[model samples]
Target: MRPEGIRLLPWLIGAVDLVMIALATVLAIRLRITLPIFSAAGDVLENTALASVFFLGTWLVLLVYSGAYEPHVFGAGTEEFKLVVNASFFTAALVATMAYLMQYPLSRGFFVLYFPLGVIALLVGRLLSRRVIQRLRSAGHFNEKVLLVGTPGYIGEIHTVLARESWLGYDVMGCLVPRDYAGLEVTSAGVPVLGLSEDVRAVVDEVSPDVVFFTAGAVSSSTQLRRLAWDLEDHAHVQIIVAPNVTDVSSERVRIRPVAGLPLMHLGRSRSQLATNDAKRAFDVIGSLTVLALTWPLLVVMMLWIKVHDGGPVLFRQTRVGRQGVEFTCLKLRSMAIDAEDRLTELEARDHVLFKSADDPRVTRPGRFIRRFSLDELPQLWNVVRGEMSLVGPRPPLPTEVEQYEDDMLRRLNVMPGMTGLWQVSGRSDLSWEDTVRLDLYYVDNWSMVQDLLILARTVTAVLGSRGAY
Candidate 1:
């Protein structure tokens, strides 16, 4: 897409939102008043129609004010949906307050219904828009040209991430390395060198990029950054973004505190520090019981299948490390031969930390089918109900695996082991040992109720896809 056409993307989103809000308004009137669209004329109906126009105007204004239409939030992250929700609820409250103060007899039912309808419609519309935009980005449309400035290693790190997540729509046009490293032609990640980092403004002007990303080591000091910012004021179309060295931290944990013109990022405590509380415990217990109640019959069938496969034990109980380094009996339906543990020392290990193989000879016929869709994990729900596990957390490691953990890896022990976690949803046994540890640490540092819910939701898709399950 042309730059000018790209500029209209936000307006296009606004147009889609306008239609969604209008549909909500009509639906709210229909449901609340039980009348056709603006028909069956009466004072109350006439007043309601007029009030809806005001509501529509207020909703659009609030959406824009909430930054829902900003280009940065176009098709990625939770910011756009969060803004839509906040704006919808705020508009509802504001409208209700104005009506009460003005002594206008607005239909209470319509007022209550409209905002919720609008929120749902807007959210659905936004999700659909995201799908379309992501497809376009994959086809090389609606992408922002990004120019990077930093040391080669830092620039390469940023480039690697952008290249991996195409849906983020960042196209690395080129980069500027420190003057001492100007002899290099391209970054390790293959981003071509455009100029010296000290001459960032000239490079940016010459490249005409949509975004200029300054990673650590891009400037000698804050004064240099300030001076560069001042100089770049002429390039009104370019956006300057400074990236800290941190990665995998959630936005909820970071607060921007600007003191004396310096921005400081204050990170909140990790979930391991706070530990599990009554709310998470309650969610675990309730979620486990609910899932168990629905799947008990399936569980029984799996047990029977496993038992019949080899006339072996139906349940496989193994010692696994739990919260605070405690050991618990982690249970799963038997997916291997009775002597599988005895053969562990004989088989070659695929992963350095975790033991898994796609075609292990110990796996019985029933094991392959159950392991494919993770039906073997159903038995662990009982562990969750017993309080030895959670509905979502870091994957429980075996006692042997715990012995190999470094000090940083020990942080996973702070939270209760989970039936399914970031590891399970990500790739199960397919992830590299380092990637598994990184994801677990990220979850331990940034776990939240909402995040748990989202992970649970993704777990279904992951299980169905069975991309990495052994």
Candidate 2:
């Protein structure tokens, strides 16, 4: 959903909350036998219009101030409850404080009642709302049909994610794979297939998607990409969102503009990042030192185990290029026999398949256990601390891979390589070579801090699921 849609949800939620709070406040005042407006019924009608107004106004102000009425509350169970708890207490306290300062007098128990009432109303109402939305979307009554446009390599992955995520409210109408895509075949299921190479208007007429997502990674030339967008606007009465191909790069680090017929994209650390450059440096220094301090024990244990298990050093180091083509030693736990590298020649032609195999004869017993959950990557935190890598960015390529990079792919090396990045969360080794290059290029051109944080969040999900981990 768009951010605006999320904003709308809170308004509805806030309305429901206001009514509930007013009803509760009315009952609470009646229990105290001090009903101001209920006097019309000889304090027996149980009507408390006065307190109802007080709570309605108070809750409205509190909800707005606390950002309680936002779309995030729809999916936010505890988070929404936290905002409710805080807003409710603030309302009660504000009322009490105002009365005390004015010497109007009010009981403290009223304030105590606010907590349970607001929290319960907020949780139950939202839980029910969620069920309604889930049911509606699952049945396709409340969902959007989307036609994705991207290179053949990227379309399959996009389809896979959308097919699995039903709550996202998106139904895959079909995919438009770039006509120019020379490598990789499309995945089957979840959606129909369309031609990516055609003009946007033609595809729009055929698919009739409510929303159009144009993937930047599919096409390399900016001029052609812009023309495609213009054609889409001319052809369809649909909402269009441009998704640049970059995977790990954050938007905060990217800027875009039209220069003549070309779309020029600028990417780098911004002023905000400049301010935190020192902070990152400090984190690198402190976090690395802390890990080193605590892991010496593990290091000792692993060193001895590796000596007994595989008769090699526990630490595996490789020289990889870092920022500005600078070379640094990348560290990792040793997971293979010492001669595993020597066996590469025999597995050379099958390297791609070998890299993805769940079980491999080359992996030692301990190696298999550690690699399954990424314990083998723990030592790379040292490379990050050493300033040779970042928390998020394009993946570091091997020296041989770098030598084979095409002109367009060179943009990836402009920024520091990261220990974990968009590729890791998006499918890692399962991603085709073309898709990997496209994602890295997109990230390099569209770097931003928010994007980095999102990548980090997605990384957690990817890691826990062990999706494409090998």
In terms of lDDT, which candidate is strongest?
Answer: 1
lDDT of 1 by residue, 276-303 (tens): 9899999989989999999999998889
Global lDDT of model 2: 0.65
lDDT of residue 9 for candidate 1: 91
Model 2 vs. true fold: TM: 0.54
Residue 138 accuracy (lDDT) in model 2:
61
The global C-alpha lDDT for each of the candidates, from Candidate 1 onward, is 0.86, 0.65
Q: Model 1, poorest ten-residue lDDT window?
A: 35-44
Count clashing pairs, candidate 1: 0
Which residue ranges in model 1 land beyond 4 Å of their true spot?
A: 1-57, 74-76, 98-141, 342-347
Model 2 has how many clashing residue pairs? 10
TM-score top scorer: 1
